[model samples]
Target: MTEDQSALKTLSEVVRDRRLQLGLSTRALAQRCIDPGTGKAIPRHYIQRLEDDLANLAPPRLPELSALAAGLELPLAVIQEAAGFQFHGVTTRHSESGRARMFVARFDELDPAEQDRVLAMLEAYTAVKPPKVD
Candidate 1:
């Protein structure tokens, strides 16, 4: 990443890591990332540019984002949110873990009783002793 990239999980990092984790090359990823809007494969160079953190590149639209998410075998919301935070400066109450982040992101939209129930369940989970690590 460039010197200016934030420490938070970024679109660039997610794309690169997921691609590598799946043993896909840029060309393979591009072949999978077919833009639904145009039914055309996203160019390999575009995928490379995204992984390279090319400055001033616009945040991908929903179609590219959706294709990328599928190409990486990840949820669209996760990729979309990461892209927003990385490229658009979207403010979020950062969580150390992705599960916590997902919960926090949607928690505010829940009804009061629903939120209370979720918190209660969470408390119960925490109250149980975790298995001892060797």
Candidate 2:
């Protein structure tokens, strides 16, 4: 596969991983996308296609992303990261143990719950911590 295709694959994997982590089935996520104002829903098959990487839906509109993040009860940054597009100024580092360490070294982008989840996962997976000094 070409570099772009490889990147897209990585992006797709990220989304799938995060979606699973959030405990959302594709159909449930699709239902969450219903347009409140118009009472219309984006089709479940379309969502399945997107998650399965059979189709690359374009970057979601702001409102759509917002509603999705809200429904998933996750920060937009988390969704965006899973979607493989980081917002400006977010940096990520991977520890020696292979745990992803994200540094929002700019703004306090993630809410407390998201932070807790991330930290808990990191601790569970890698037991990461600063080395003790003499």
Candidate 3:
């Protein structure tokens, strides 16, 4: 198969798998893909078509893909990669464990009181952050 066709198949499979892994229905997933700027959810039919591999539907635009990433709790790079874009820099992206290790390096250096403050600040941030679309 051609590269683009292979990528399209990959994207289709990934989206379906991620949605199922997250226990989301197509309608729910579509709701999560709402345009932040326009406040419009991606058409549920379109998501279904993509997942079902119906012909003639366009590849999702960057914004829609980004929304899907946020909704699916996946890194944007994963979706981008499945869409056939090769990243040139950094050889590979850092894993979640690597990110945690980096975070600990700085967090561990802080004093106890500072650590407590930071934890409290993070808690506040979490409380105020927008709720994920259900």
Candidate 4:
């Protein structure tokens, strides 16, 4: 297991706090979000439910997750990480700190062709690893 890379918060708090930080009303947040997969605007009522009672709600699917990330103006990885830990009750070793971590977190945003190239690069690079410098 990896050390915590960020402070823990429930998905509700993550969304609510970020929304407030952006000075967005719940409706405004919802208005700004659309399911990336469907290209449909997310309902304001759904946003309200998420902020008000996320614990009782099923974890959002991938498209909604993308929408929330856009809405919150956070990387999709941050939202995914929070949701994964909070709802799935598990965390990932792949989730790391610093630039490398951010690279992996945003990796999913890449297209499949790009992902293949990245994976190839990762494998080639890691095949000749040097020790980290302090």
Candidate 5:
């Protein structure tokens, strides 16, 4: 396979790994995409093709990726990374201290309303730092 195809295969593997880690069957995941207005389920075959890497679904369309991320309760960035795309703005530091400080600073940089929304989201999804004791 060409490099691009290999990369796509790796990305597909990542998606499959994440899906399995989340314990979602292809059919179950498709059901999560049910259209609210129509109440029609997304076809299971579409999901199966995606998981099997049999379809050209790598670099999945944004709306579908967003739905899968929501259904998996995963951060969009994590999903994007799994899909072989890196988010540009988020910084990654080598040291844990630097990482923590950067995270806090990034957290602070948001507007107050956005900060509240982000904090609420973080609380709902993953563990956050407790207030410093000392």
Candidate 6:
């Protein structure tokens, strides 16, 4: 399998395993993924297909992936990276207080495609902006 496919397979395994660990049915998971703004739940069949690796839905839009992460209660960054979002440089440093410092990018520093996906997710999460008070 190609590198991307291999990564996706790993992701599929993670999703299935985590779901089982949480004692959630496929339909339950889908229900958890309901978009607050849209009130749309990801279909149970799609989740099943994803877990079975019968679905080629990798590199999904960031909004969709974030919703999945919300339903799964997994780290968004972990899911995002597993979904093939390119990350920027990572660095670890030590401070005078003996604390470790880890640096990572949240959304910026990704490739254009990944950036667009993240932007879409942000938009979805903040569908209604607060009223401006000048």
**Model 5 vs. true fold: TM:** 0.46
lDDT of 6 by residue, 6-103 (tens): 44425566678889999999999988976544566778887887787663454456566667777888866555655552222222233566432212
| Candidate 2 Cα misplacement greater than 4 A, ranges | 1-11, 34-41, 84-134
**Tens-digit lDDT string for candidate 3 (94-118):** 4667885455546745778999999
Tens digits of per-residue lDDT, candidate 4, 1-134, equal 23564556656778999999999998899988876767877688888887786567888888888899888888888888788877886664553447777688768989999999999999999999998899
Against the reference, the lDDT scores of all candidates come to 0.81, 0.56, 0.68, 0.81, 0.58, 0.64
Sort the candidates on TM-score, descending order. Answer: 4, 1, 6, 3, 5, 2
lDDT of 1 by residue, 1-134 (tens): 44334566889989999999999999999889975556766788888999999988888987888789778888776787779877997645546666877777577457689999999999999999799899
Q: Name the lDDT of candidate 2.
A: 0.56
Better of 3 and 4 by TM-score: 4
| Candidate 6 residue pairs that clash | none
- The model with the greater TM-score, 1 or 3, is 1
Over 1-134, each residue of candidate 2 has an lDDT whose tens digit, in order, gives 44434343233465466568879887777777654445556667766666666543665554555545555666655555545542232334446664334354212356678888877887886876668799
Query: Model 6 has how many clashing residue pairs?
Result: 0
Clashing residue pairs for model 1: none
What residue pairs clash in candidate 5, if any at all? none
User: All predictions: root-mean-square deviation over Cα?
Assistant: 8.9, 9.9, 13.8, 3.9, 9.9, 12.5
lDDT of 6: 0.64
In model 4, what lDDT does residue 106 have? 68
Q: Write the per-residue lDDT of candidate 5 for residues 20-125, one digit (tens) a residue.
A: 8878887777777543334555567766776676645544555665566566666554555455432222222335556764566466446689999988988876
Q: Mind sharing the TM-score for model 6?
A: 0.54
- Candidate 1 residue-wise lDDT at 81: 72
